[model samples]
Target chain A: DAGVTQSPTHLIKTRGQQVTLRCSPKSGHDTVSWYQQALGQGPQFIFQYYEEEERQRGNFPDRFSGHQFPNYSSELNVNALLLGDSALYLCASSSTGGGDEKLFFGSGTQLSVL
Target chain B: LAKTTQPISMDSYEGQEVNITCSHNNIATNDYITWYQQFPSQGPRFIIQGYKTKVTNEVASLFIPADRKSSTLSLPRVSLSDTAVYYCLVAPGNRKLIWGLGTSLAVNP
Candidate 1:
């Protein structure tokens, strides 16, 4: 079975520019979540998607948005990116079973904002 | 969401057991303790999880006391590859989880 997959392992962007990252859920998984990890820090939750609708969001700005396709794939869009936006964007997937299910994470896309 | 606290860093030699403890003083009754391991520039991987008592897996073991306010992740027979950051998370029904600076374990030869 395939694990979670993410596109654009690394990216470079300037301030005020927009970047889009993609994620494919693991086999037999339906839920997708996004996280951001800065240098020397743990990951912070961005949001979660289920049933093609956003279920819960973290304390992120409106510039950060996402979409979940019919096949359970996800896209994370960051607009007006700032220098601080440069970090590792991680995509995690889990099933729709009990809430305690473990999450499988992708290697993540390294975003660099200039 | 319950908050978790772990050590900043630890050093252990190979062939010895390493235990990383996490404290969640305000853990809810329904909250469960989970652990994740992450190497440099890589995504975190699930190590083990438990609600109470002891749960052992192939890679690690999770020990949660009856109070449920704290837990420990024990790695037996550590090696250089076992050097990574370990996170402890407490989630009730797996809602919005808050991750803190995890404990960084460095296994030496």
Candidate 2:
């Protein structure tokens, strides 16, 4: 089966610019979550989308938002980007019912905020 | 969310077994211990998970003590390809996983 897939492996954006990163969850999975990893740091939770609605969120700001399409694909949008926004944007997919909620991650999109 | 603490970095020779331990003193009753491995530019991949006692898998082994305050990830016969950052996370059911800095393991030739 295909694993979690993300688009635009690498991206460049200037300050105040907006960017959107896409993700397609693994087949048979329905929940999508986003995370950000800075240099020399572990991935930080951004938010999670289930049933086309944001179910839980982390400490990130409003500029960071996400959407889960009906097809289970997800998009992470960050507005008014700052240089500090530069990091690796990761998408993880998991299912909610039945089995354990083990997450499968994508290769991630590297966001470079200039 | 339970807070996790692990080593900043570790080094092991090829063919040697490596054990990385993580501490989560405030771990709740419902939380589960999960480990993830990450390469230089890739997303974290789930390694193994356990709640209590020991759990072994093809790639690695997880040991959770009865107290559940700490867990260890053991990788046997390490190779250069085994080098990566290992994260210890605590999640309550299907909630957001809390990630710590993680232990950076380097397997040398």
Candidate 3:
């Protein structure tokens, strides 16, 4: 079975621009979560979506938003982006049937804000 | 502060066992410890998780102490492909939104 997949593998945009990143969850997965990892640091939570609704969000600002389609694919949008927004944007897939669920991740989109 | 503290990085040779430990002194009552592996520019892949005691799976074994305050990830006979960052995360509540710094593991050929 194919694992999770992300688009554009890498992206480049100017400061104050807007960018959209997409993720397709793994097969048989229902929940999707997004994360951001700066250089030499750990991945930070952005938000999680289940049943086409955002269930929880992290400490990121409003400029960061996401949507989960009925098909379980997700999109993360950043508006008026700053240089700091450049990082590895990760997408994780998980199942909800069990109380303690594990996530399967996709090779993230490497966003570079110039 | 997160509930876990692990090493920044570790080194291992091919066919050698690699063990990475994390410390979580203030783990939540309902929290479970999870470990993830990430290659460069890739998302974190879940390795294993356990609440307490020990849990073993096909790929790796997770050893959690009785106190639930710490956990270890043991990889048997690692290879160069195992050179990646390993993250330890704590999910304490109904929602699993907590993610922190993961340990970096470098496996030499």
| DockQ metric for all predictions | 0.73, 0.65, 0.58
**Order the candidates by TM-score, highest first — what do you get?**
1, 2, 3
C-alpha RMSD between model 1 and the true structure: 0.7
Top candidate when judged by TM-score against the true structure = 1
The digit string of per-residue lDDT tens for model 2 on A1-114 reads 899999999999999999999999999999999999999988889999999999999999999999999999999999999999999999999998742578899999999988
Residue-by-residue lDDT tens digits, candidate 1, B3-103 = 88899999999999999999999998878789999998889999998999999999999998889989999999999999999999999654467889899
Worst 10 residues of 2 chain A by lDDT: A95-104
Model 3 lDDT per residue over A1-114, tens place: 988999879999999999999999999999998989898888788999999999998899999999999999999999998999999998988887765788888999999999
| lDDT over C-alpha atoms for residue A81 of model 2 | 99
Give per-model TM-scores.
Answer: 0.98, 0.97, 0.92
- Docking verdict class for candidate 2: medium
Clashing pairs in 2: none
Q: After superposition, how far is residue B98 of candidate 3 from its true place, in Å?
A: 3.3
Interface RMSD of each: 1.2, 1.8, 2.2
User: How far off is model 3, as Cα RMSD?
Assistant: 1.8
Pairs that clash in candidate 1: none
Off by over 4 Å in 2: none
Error of 3 at B83 (Å): 1.4
| Predicted model with the maximum DockQ | 1
The order of the candidates by DockQ, greatest first, is 1, 2, 3
State the C-alpha lDDT per candidate.
Answer: 0.93, 0.92, 0.86
